[model samples]
Target: MSITNNGISIVPSFSLEKPATVFNMSIAKGRFSFDPELAFSLEAKPWYSLFWFRYNLSPKQSKFNMNVGTHLGLNFVNIPFPNAKDSIQIQKTDRYLVLEIFPRYKFSKHLTMGVYYLRSHGLDPATLNALNFVTLYTEISQIQLSKKATLGISPQLYYLNIDGNHGYYLTSEISLSLQNFPVIIKSTINKTFETKVEGSKPFLWNIKLVYPLKGGKIKP
Candidate 1:
């Protein structure tokens, strides 16, 4: 069974002149996956959401593949983007029209390396007339280890640029698939080395434990 839960981050922030707490609460409707060679999905939370469409630029599922996509995301929560080394000045939510492309090549079926790039300069949601933040995001990962029934490890590099501000993050992630249950688990820990934004985090840690719902049920 899947349940709504609370998540904690070690990173600190200031909200309304007081330091913000570490806990976040949210709900999920479960996974919505697409079949066939053309891949894409839309995940909805309680609030506003976005759409994504992925088109394979090369062969659909090849050892060496190239793909491009767009993510339609909006920021309604006015969540502040943090800076690692300095205290940030809070701002409004940024509506995004991010363009993405990724290339992946596998040394073997179980091991792979890939890089993902995204660029966006967004509009203000309320008015939909103002444009503010321009950001670029990049992620690179290598699947160095894997166990079919256990875990997979990937060391990642994250770079983010907003307007002219920039930050770099190094992260490690583990994905675990259990033996008897239809559950997927993941954990990530990241450290930010430098940040141009003031309120950014120095370290980020997150975990996800959920059963992927398929066709109104958890798939085995």
Candidate 2:
């Protein structure tokens, strides 16, 4: 979800599926001043997990002066079935855990990039005993705007050597602030396709209306 307070912004978002999932929290403040800033996010997936945090100390004179932080996550899974009579039926679940550190750099006002390294493990009692591996990821984003609206695009790539699987995704979103109403309309589309993976490819399309509960500097 995305929220704004007095023109400041905070977006807490997440996604999930059968073999993969993700969680994230991001914040932006002081947009109308020379010292605008942002915060970190926590994310997790099927064979990978990550905890990353960052802060902008100053922007007017030292736009690159920023503080960085890190954390780790672990995941596992288990599945069991009963084939005999008088046996208890059970469905196994998978779990995963990872330990990770976050490194990032800011190039300019509308661009930033980051990378992550993780030590990950998984457990599924039904088909396999336990699995362990390491993974690496990189992400990039760009924000631009016309005189009346804003647009953002982000793409991420990942490598999982243990499973011999590599994946990439592209996500695009746009929002427009209407002239008369106290609302902004937003929509997004995300696509992910893999070389050896089999299953349905997920697609998402949504339109959201957002406005402040309490009035502030009304956009004219």
TM-score, per-candidate, Cα-based: 0.61, 0.42
How many clashes in each structure?
7, 18
After superposition, the stretches of candidate 2 with alpha carbons farther than 4 Å from their true spots are: 1-92, 124-148, 160-162, 167-194, 198-220
Model number with the top TM-score: 1
| Location of the lowest summed lDDT over 10 successive residues in candidate 1 | 10-19
The positional error of residue 214 in candidate 2, measured at the CA in angstroms, is: 12
Q: How high is the lDDT of residue 2 in model 1?
A: 25
lDDT digits (tens) for residues 1-220 of candidate 2: 2322111111111122222222333433442212212211222213323333344444556534433332333222222455755554453334444344444556665566665444445544432232222223222333335455555444434432335443444444556654456765655444554433233134534444455344244354
lDDT of 1 by residue, 1-220 (tens): 2222223221111112211212122222222222211111112222223455566666545688766766566543534458645554454545667566767777675567777666665655443332222212222333334444666777666666655666666667577776677876766566778777556667655565656655444455
Candidate 1 lDDT at 189 equals: 65
Query: What is residue 186's positional error in candidate 2, in angstroms?
Result: 6.3
Per-residue error (Å), model 2, residue 132: 9.9
